[model samples]
Target: MTRLNHQEKAKEFDKWISWKQEGNKDAETELIMRFLPLVTKVANRLAIGLPATVDKEDLISFGRFGLLDALQKFDHTRGLQFETYAMWRIRGAMIDGLRENDWIPRTVRDKAKKIEEAYTRLEQEKLRTPTDAEVCEYLGMTEKELQQVLYDTSLAAMVSIDEAVGEEDEQKTARHSYIVDEMTPRPESVAEAKSLKEVLSKCIDKLPEKERLVVSLFYFEELTLSEIADVMNLSPSRISQLHSKAIFRLRSALTRWKSQLL
Candidate 1:
């Protein structure tokens, strides 16, 4: 990759197009074989907090389809990181399959419900990310107690990306629909998407300093909780607390922004 000059980059993309777009079976197989581990990795991350009844192997299988979809649709010429982009596709596919199987454990739902509702309502009323103190007071808990609860409940909160995706026959929830990967979409849709991205950017900027950094390091850098803790000079449990809070705040912002976007 370091040896690739500008023209060589174009050549590389051309090769990808010929192999992937022009039906080179061998190339497709190689691509899948190379990225099979990535699928497994994504599956493992998503499989956290899932039910024992939900087979981990099934998650890997769903992620394989995500890898295939990404290979077909990804633009190597765009100069984006394939792993980062494919993570979204892989996760979306895994979540889609889980929903199809109705694998959303009711226990997770019940665990998240009271906290999510309280957080959402507070954010709406305050029009900003609520403080841990504020949230704890609202929920009738102390700081020490709330920290453990947030870390323990983080899994329930983290898996809500596009969790409300409706079927083709049903109306979709625009708020949760952030993963917009389409080839050759309409001009209006592209403009609208850019605007929505701007809104999301502003929302992230509005998060508390620590929560924003935690979000960036976790999602954009793909760092683990312990790694992020090392980077931020905080405990892994602290990082997790911030992560859970950030997700909840972002979801609340999306709900408020969706009304205007629609």
Candidate 2:
């Protein structure tokens, strides 16, 4: 099938929605066939750069279920276009699949859960996102320790909410309601982000042992200078000095690389 522009897709979606409400099975099948590629594309993008075990095709399958959900729950009266509403469901289905598949190790998942909980508590208490220092303090770890944890466990990053909640169709299963907006970045931007991550990893590896440890503990583990000092058995001032020097070196390296790229 030919791809449609957003406006044309929206019209097609509305017709499907109307036909679906009247118990039209054929319309439902047609809608699924028409939009399955879009759902698969979103799923594939979400799985990009993940471990091979993540299985992009599995995410696509999960997204198919989410697509059905979108078809059923869409409401034209809300003045929201269907594609805008469906993207979230599609992504959410993929995440739910990941969770069910046990792709993330149990220990890492536990750590991620703790981090999430800590963030939640901090938000409730402070009414804002918790600072990196606050997270270190809460965990009773030094800054370096926190950074190590963050770097080592960075793969545990939470799924974006854009891929989490969405409206569900009445005739379909009760899927989470997610708000979809037009914030999806271009594919090239996604590729650049991946390249930057690889570069950062390489840079981290090239640091002197002490500087590398400091960088890992401070940035990835989310440790404050004092906390890192405690772990390294040094004064907070010393840890701060090390951190400053490491950051300067990293910035200089990245600057040179960017200049070369340009």
Candidate 3:
């Protein structure tokens, strides 16, 4: 998609409104073209850490199919917003394609699993979050090796977040849409959003110091890993490892909470 000025964006939005409300067949091509930006955005994000052999266009193609599927199957009358749902579907589709392609090696996934196991076992044994030194010792790995493993598994953590988590025979809620309230009678209620956010806030508070800071800087402050490394005076590789560990803990917490709801 070409870079659009404010007026151009407004015009496109107007076209979308017409296509949505009036069912204008003439605007359908424009509609598909407009979706390219969304696909491109997700493709770029997921392209990180991928091997050079993996073409960016392939990821975009996967996301394009997701967008097409989303457009076809989406219930316009359900009143649920489309963009958020479609984002998850697009990411999920790209990850699905990557998995089928074996883009992430099995060894990396096994290493990540072992690290998580070490976290759980050490926590159960000591009744607290395990220190990095302790986790390294438990895994019989050097600090550098642990960092490499964490970095390798970071993409897996990302794939986990891309899951579509609903139980319907068809479309389900997007897992990465963050928190959707199952407890509330009204899923769209503002209080429902707040409650789920509070749960995540509490989980963040429970993280160890360095991991917590890494998440804060990366998510809240929107800093890249290299920028975070500069601010923290650590290597970018180390920051990537911390980011991976932080996401792993978050994913575990959210999954457990979701299971309880189920």
lDDT comparison, 1 vs 3, better candidate: 3
lDDT of 2: 0.58
Clashing pairs in model 1?
none
- Write the candidate numbers in order of decreasing TM-score: 3, 1, 2
Which 10 successive residues of model 3 have the least lDDT summed? Answer: 176-185
**TM, every model:** 0.69, 0.46, 0.76
lDDT digits (tens) for residues 70-97 of candidate 3: 7666665565555655666787789888
lDDT of candidate 1 over 172-214, digit per residue (tens): 3333334233321335456656665566678779889998897
RMSD of 3: 4.3
Model 1 / residue 112 / CA error / Å: 2.2
In order, the Cα lDDT scores of the candidates are 0.68, 0.58, 0.71
Q: Candidate 2 has what TM-score?
A: 0.46
Q: Each prediction's Cα RMSD? A: 5.2, 15.6, 4.3
Q: Provide the global lDDT of candidate 3 against the true structure.
A: 0.71
Candidate numbers, best lDDT first, in rank order = 3, 1, 2
